[model samples]
Target: MTPRTPDAVTVFGPDFPFAYDDWLTAPEGVGSIPPEHHGAEVAIVGGGLSGLVAAHELLRLGLKPVVYEGARLGGRLRSEHFGGPDGPVAEMGGMRFPISSSTFFHYVRTLGLATAPFPNPLTPASRSTVVDLEGETFYATSLDDLPDLFREVADAWDGALDRILHLGGLQAAIRRRDTGALKAIWDALVPLWDDRSFYDFVATSEEFQALSFRHREVFGQVGFGTGGWDSDFANSMLEILRVVVTNCDSDQHLIRGGADQVPRGLWSRRVDDAAHWPEGTSVESLNGGSPRGSVTGIHRVRDSAGTATDRIAVTDESGETREYPAVLATCQSWLLTTQIACDEELFSQKMWMALDRTRYMQSSKTFVMVDRPFWNDVDPATGRHVMSMTLTDRLTRGTYLFEEGPEDPAVICLTYSWMSDALKMLPHPAERRMELALEALSHIYPGLDIRSHIVGDPITVSWEDDVHFLGAFKGALPGHYRYNHRMYSHFVQQAMPPEERGLFIAGDDVSFTPAWAEGAVQTSLNSVWGIMAHFGGSSPATNPGPGDLFDELGPIRLPD
Candidate 1:
């Protein structure tokens, strides 16, 4: 792999599109503290899944964790509102959960959050010519359907599908050193699986033949090697497939308002005297001595309405100083590393050097509410039987039409993944996403007329680059989990000398589980346990701490 350029700056596109230099300031500041705020024990950063989980877990274990969030709770699990000038409810982020998420399932039960089964596409927009030229879009519905979907796309594609269909006895081959079966019909697959750009993989695969002009987007949109091969972040196309393919029995689910309901339910049931908003906002003041140059106090950051009042700030509204023995960070790992000052370094030189391993990008979202359920034929281009796929010729692949509002059942969303589509989207600085969504939807449902079936205009969300670390609710890049296997190393660094365990990690970012409520709970449990262990206690096996996060291991296959 070629070396990727280092980028510490991200220009927010729709939300806060300014360069880092504009708003970013060193965590270090030469300021004095107020006289009121003081503290002890652990401080948790971010109110997102990871942060809240860690805080609640610590609280469950009889530990007092002072939680600091730049924004209100329910991080990315937020609800996007529309309608009536006060914003009617709609989903802007993660809309549903899959059945394969067992951990998440148990957590949902524990929280007692009401759920409805995930919905399938009522309309089709996927281009069969792109995904697979085989049969119909439902070909993806079952493994046996592969031949149908693979027939005309490409010999290479068909051969790959045949190889997949021949999964018999391969379980035994997994343990074995070699298997000729993989190469029998899949000679072209290994190369593509290992390194083909999503775009090239689709173009060259039998799937592309499945597409038609009506919907060439569904398949073409998902695969892209855009910024050059080096630009790809992690290798997880096959893994993503695993989630879908292996999840045959696992149906999906959606909450009423937003995904945030899961976390809110958890908080409402557990945690004592949880100091959440709705009453007051802003952390007025702080009263603490600087550990080093880092300010260990209540943060007085702004809230929902962009106001600094009423919202809970780390300190009093006026700015006060406080202290904690340790702090658990829950947002993106980079946020805690850069935004907050932790006098000590939790990672070694080697780990620090590899910090360049990850990169993030902007993905825009739009939710449109309609008067009636608008349906369309599946796109022949991508070969999928879903109405959510865009039938437009524009760049930036649109989203898969998964489900609709179970209650209202009249709203829909379109996700434009800029990084995935073989082409980048138009550079319309202002209404880019909204315009795209409206235009694309109109291509298929010209009758509903967005202005008519649409109960409300589109609500846009351009938050990928916000400091709140708003958009990364999905899984982390591939190697973050494998390479940083030893979460114990984090505790080790804290245990070592000057820095101590002042900085704690929280959030779904740290998990064998991907981005979901379950992963957040596990991350929180393990992180809290790490703190408890320091104070003298052990963690549950199911929820291992840093010890598990960074555990080193021996190689499986040696020099062959």
Candidate 2:
């Protein structure tokens, strides 16, 4: 097997194989709009990463972007500081980023932010990994050091993927950027796997069925890459295959300051090459240094003859309504139905069904600031670090330790769980969640006093409970591929009726690969192209956008 290189693979899409990175970095820039629409305000409904990315690019393309954010900037890329501005932060959401996310890294590097390898289970970045399951504990620096059962389970997964999904060939095609080979392989698998669940694939596979049930259980509890996969067992196999083929699970890193910096940076950073705006102009400056209040309603303005026009009217919380040539919605799909009152005519019934059926997975993370990286202290009897990066079937499914410096305070993600595991702590408060996490860890490290190292109050978040964001990210279920296709392809308005045009949607949920920042960045670029085309703009001859090649390379439509 070929060793995976961080730069070799990217989220270039088995669904839509477009080189967004090249298009973005093109010398000609994203594209140019007509002089008539140079300063025409385009309403951006959310201030999250997707919204901010689209706003920044639109600003550079000579469009006036009026950003409206309900709660705060950064959305799911939230990082909460424990003490002062310079204090340690608890990443409430989006802590790890895979190096395969090239488009996302484009923004990260452009913003001058720093990053380091995340301490995933058994990774070299982690000093050691401790796997505790069924009240048994094992410590290992590498996979080779673990028991034979561990290696057997790992081999079974590799064998199953290669035999069933043609993992190696598919990944090779992705790495080579061979669109023909990619589409040939992926389009066939889409129909075959989209209607099946991840668990079904594992259970029905010859490799896993030949092994004991214990091996399958162990595989789910301590899965490859990040951690457990049992939570995602019910998700469509297509979703799991995308993650594996794109390398979204491995070679991950965390931003030095926080993940939130990417969005906040895009919001404040001045685009010196802006077409119409001044040299120091930014998304923040264009929106008066802060975004407008929450959007209350989105309606279509009609002419005196009662015919819908091109203008879309957006009403803010303050009761002020403004008309814009285009409106980009980057908020959670459910919000369009729950919080905002969107006009029925804005989207077709099929598109509305897609939006309403989009499912979001639940997630909860608890963090605590420690006095120092005390976990590095070694135990005389065991000759191992006091406590290593932990993965367990216990309440605390995963625990990650972060160190800034020996002298500076550190942060520990006591628990990071998704789906059912996240729901276990949903009803608890921050302090209680920390207590439960500590109690779970105590059982693994018999005498380790993790609470003694704590210096600040604990921070916790259950994304589902937050009304602004109903869930963490989209987790497509079996038989929902058609719905996903509808949402993802909505940006191309060339075939849409006049009433169904102008309002665009971009976010990770609307993408084929959700829960990754790369999806948000890619979808935002798609909307940028869609909005530019709506305003009589065209891509450079040297570099065409996603919409330019969308018809030829768009996702395969699954029969309804």
Candidate 2 C-alpha lDDT tens digits along 1-560? 11234438889898999999889888878899999889999999998999999999999999999999989999999989879877887888888999888889989888999889998999988889999999999999999989999999999999999999999988888889899999999999999998899999999999889999998899999999998899999999999999999999998999988899999999999899999888999999888899999998999999999988989999999999999989999999999999999999999999999999999999999999999999899999989999999999999999999998987899999999999899999999999999999999999998988888899789999999999899999999999899999999998999998999999999999999999999999999999999999999989878989999999999999767
- The candidate scoring highest on TM-score is 2
Candidate 1 structure, TM-score to reference: 0.61
lDDT (0 to 1) per candidate: 0.42, 0.92
> What TM-score, to 2 decimals, does candidate 2 have?
0.98
Error of 1 at 28 (Å): 44
Model 1, runs deviating above 4 Å: 1-40, 84-88, 120-250, 270-319, 344-346, 354-356, 374-396, 399-409, 420-432, 446-448, 470-483, 486-502, 512-518, 539-560
Rate residue 391 of model 2 by lDDT.
94
